[model samples]
Target: MNTIEQQLWEYIDGDLDEFSKKAIEEKIKSDARIKVQYEELLKLNSAFSALDLDEPSMSFTRNVMESIALAPAPVAMKTKVDKKIIYAIGGFFIVSLLFLFGYSIYSSNLSMPKLDFNFNFNLDRYITPTVLYSFLFFDLVIGLVFLDQFLRKRINKEH
Candidate 1:
């Protein structure tokens, strides 16, 4: 936006600081151009204030009333779900996961599985620590970017 528009908006909104407001007021008083612009803004503001919002179409109320009439009568939708049971079920799942994870860790050496391939692909020529780390980093960054976009779209979605 232009500086004039910026100042005009700030002045209109009473957002200008005392010094800036005084400077603008002085400019408005001295320069006919500034004075005319100020007058135009004032007129526009007054016009907006005097204006009434556009009314809905004539059938709007009838449509709404008819829909309401056709709809089922208002009834509260109170939930009958038990909170304690939900909490208990959640607790059960958490405990089961923890137990299973602990058991797996305790019983395993966390060793890499030996791959017995029939053909020699010379995988060692391509697979290195740097390549692995780079791949992991790329995947992490892609995942993070995907997650960020998903969350941003979800958050900005209208209710």
Candidate 2:
């Protein structure tokens, strides 16, 4: 026969075979020590099961919301484009390029001793300026649209 201590563990864990279970019950009838140990384990299990299920404080949600609100409300939704700014920047770059070309043309005509060199037509020079200015314009428009939406939302909220 198995000891009461080992039987009690198997019984608590619900892992005993029915014959083993019956044998343990029969042993418990004659053993006061086993019965007392079993009763103490049962009481401990019941006490653990009866814990309180109360909710946290109402201030918990409010505190979380307040903390989120206090965290500097996102840098006012900036845009990738602003049309007026783009046009102004584009105009500045175009003027600068024209000045550069004029200076280059003037400097090229200056007297130079005979040197064997061939001028290479860099397609990049033209493509780079146009592409850069166009992207700037696109970004400016996007930024302006975003700014407009942000302002409209703010105005609506105020009203």
Candidate 3:
């Protein structure tokens, strides 16, 4: 808007200092254009003041609160699971198993029987090419499933 309109608005809103107010008042009186603009603004202000503001119903707040309550709570992407505690538990089990195995071996007499390490293993009888291929295919499928789950989890975390 023009400077005149700005000054007129400030004067109408009673935002100007006494000196500026006097100056604008004199201008409004002397200038017909300013006088007309001032009158129009005054009428507009009065019309705005006369308007009946529409208010929401008494239950508006309650309805909004109820809707908000009905919404599902958001899930956090990362929950704090102490990896150190998990590792400690797993380490304890592994150490215990090793200790038990060593104890059992020690309890057995030191004069143990000498056993032959050589064995005549027949791989063709149990693991044929078809069985090997099927096992590999099964492993591949399981790997893909794990990969898919990992990617889905990563995508969910990013979002």
Question: Which ten residues in a row are the worst by lDDT in model 2?
Answer: 116-125
CA-RMSD of model 3: 11.3
Per-model CA lDDT versus the true structure: 0.74, 0.74, 0.80
lDDT of 2 by residue, 23-105 (tens): 87877787898889888877876787798778989899999999998898667866465576678668767876885785476
- Expressed as tens digits, the lDDT of each residue in 1-159 for candidate 1 is 778767976898899999999988888888998789878888888899999999999999999999999998889977565576567557656765875675465545554447543432444556567976885686577558656765776686644
TM-score between model 3 and native: 0.47
Candidate 3: list runs displaced more than 4 Å. 77-159
Q: How accurate is candidate 1 locally (lDDT)?
A: 0.74
TM-score of 1: 0.34
**How does residue 109 of candidate 2 score in lDDT?**
41
The collision pairs in model 1 are: none
- In Å, residue 24's CA in model 2 sits off its true spot by 1.2
What C-alpha lDDT, on a 0 to 100 scale, does residue 62 get in candidate 1? Answer: 95
**RMSD of every prediction:** 16.3, 15.4, 11.3
Query: What is the clash count of model 3?
Result: 0
Ranking by TM-score: 3, 1, 2
Residue-wise C-alpha lDDT for candidate 3, range 60-112, written one tens digit per residue? 99999999999999997877755765675576567658756654654454442
- Ranking 1 against 2 by TM-score, winner: 1
Model 1's number of clashes is 0
Q: Candidate 1 — which residues are off by over 4 angstroms?
A: 55-159
